[model samples]
Target: MLIAQITDTHIKLPGKLAYKKVDTAAMLKRCVDELLTLDPQPDLILLTGDLVDLGRPAEYDHLKSILAPIRQRIIAIPGNHDDREAMRGAFHAEGYLPTEGKFLQFVVEDYPLRIVGLDTLIPGEGGGELCAERLEWLDRTLAQKPDVPTLVLMHHPPFITGIGHMDKIGLKGSDGFAAVMERHRHVELILCGHLHRTIHAQVGGRPAMTCPSPAHQVALDIDPEAPSCFTMEPPGFMLHWWNGRRLVTHTAVIGSYDGPHPFFDANGKLID
Candidate 1:
């Protein structure tokens, strides 16, 4: 099974550039186009978060347009930048989210792997948290599906990435969250976003990864004292391929204008 992960598109209204800088809408369109061209198309698209710059109605409309060409099933959760009410209002008719709750949490059981969406959005806050109620729900849900290979999806990563400033704004209730995962042995992977770059770590023996945004990326500065900010680095996404027992991931960068292609042909011939 193949799962494509796209995060932090940050689409703006009327396809306008964000922060008077990055052309997010265009970049997302290019990413979608690239995904459509893949040989074995992704079975599902997991949108990790930050779908819009400000969660505006028009921004969602623009996002819908860019994603219309994607032929796979799409699942999404809200980020700190997203407004839950606004997201629900925009995607309610499409059935992209649950219809009965304040949080857009639900399960997808159609494939060999069971996928779950967790909401960690906190109103008026840059950081994320999984409250007690949500944790309880997760515990109950995992208990009910102990035998299935599960993939947990959320907007904020549940662990700290070495980037100190951003780490301060990561998931707040990580210890509590880890405790829940520790009990669910069937969980194969924990997928997330919010850091704007690809990150990998282990949480309770489960492989946890943060997908890179398709718009822009947070710089990879390891300084513990550095400030939090974004950079003009190339945007990308992750492709997770589940081959029966293990899940393998590959990162694909978007907007391919040109790059170095070093190669060596057979019989000791160098090709570039």
Candidate 2:
């Protein structure tokens, strides 16, 4: 099965751009157009977090309109920029998010890969944390179906990315999270967003990765005191393919570019 991962969309009001720079709305529309063109369309679409620039209801409305073209089911978690209650109300009809929980966490057992979405939003804080309650819930949930290959979705990546500024706002309680993963070997991958760029790491012996944004990417500066900034880098998303055994990921960059030149001639001879 193929799953498409789009994160950090940060959709704003209809006429606004993100940070007065990136045109997040337009970029997301382009990304959606690209997703619609995939040959074997993704079976599911996972929105890691930051669906809007702010947690406003109108922003959510705008986001919904932009993503209306997608027919596949979308599973989303909350990011630092998201408001839990706003998001819950916005997507309540979907029924994945719990009706009474303080967190927007949920599980999907309908597919071969069991999906476990974690809520890491810390309200007004720019950083995130998975407190003991959430950690225990994850442990208990994974214990329920030990045999099923699972995927954990959250907004903040657990590992410390070398990008200093971003790392400063990274997930707290990562050590505890790693410990939980150590006990659940069946967990296939941990999908996260918030970094706004492609990054990979291993936590508690499990693979974890962050997807790129559909608009701007966090500037790649790996210093202890890197400045906080973003760049108009090649926007992109990710495709995770589960071929019955393992999960493989590919970065799908957005926008138009060069041709699909062949390495060989029509007669099968190498082109010089």
lDDT (Cα atoms) of all candidates against the true structure? 0.88, 0.95
Question: lDDT tens digits, residues 145-234, model 2?
Answer: 999999999999999999898989999999999999999999999999999999999999999999999999999998979999999999
Per-residue lDDT over 74-120 for candidate 1, one digit per residue giving the tens place of the 0 to 100 score: 88889988988888887787575887777888888889999999999
What lDDT does candidate 1 reach at residue 28? Answer: 91
Evaluated at residue 112, the lDDT of candidate 1 is: 91
- Please report, as a residue range, the 10-residue window in candidate 1 with the lowest summed lDDT: 256-265
Highest-scoring model, TM-score: 2
Residue 36, candidate 2: alpha-carbon lDDT: 98
| Candidate 2: residue 51 lDDT (0-100) | 95
Minimum summed lDDT over a 10-residue window in model 2 is located at 14-23
Q: Which stretches of candidate 2 lie over 4 Å from their true place?
A: none
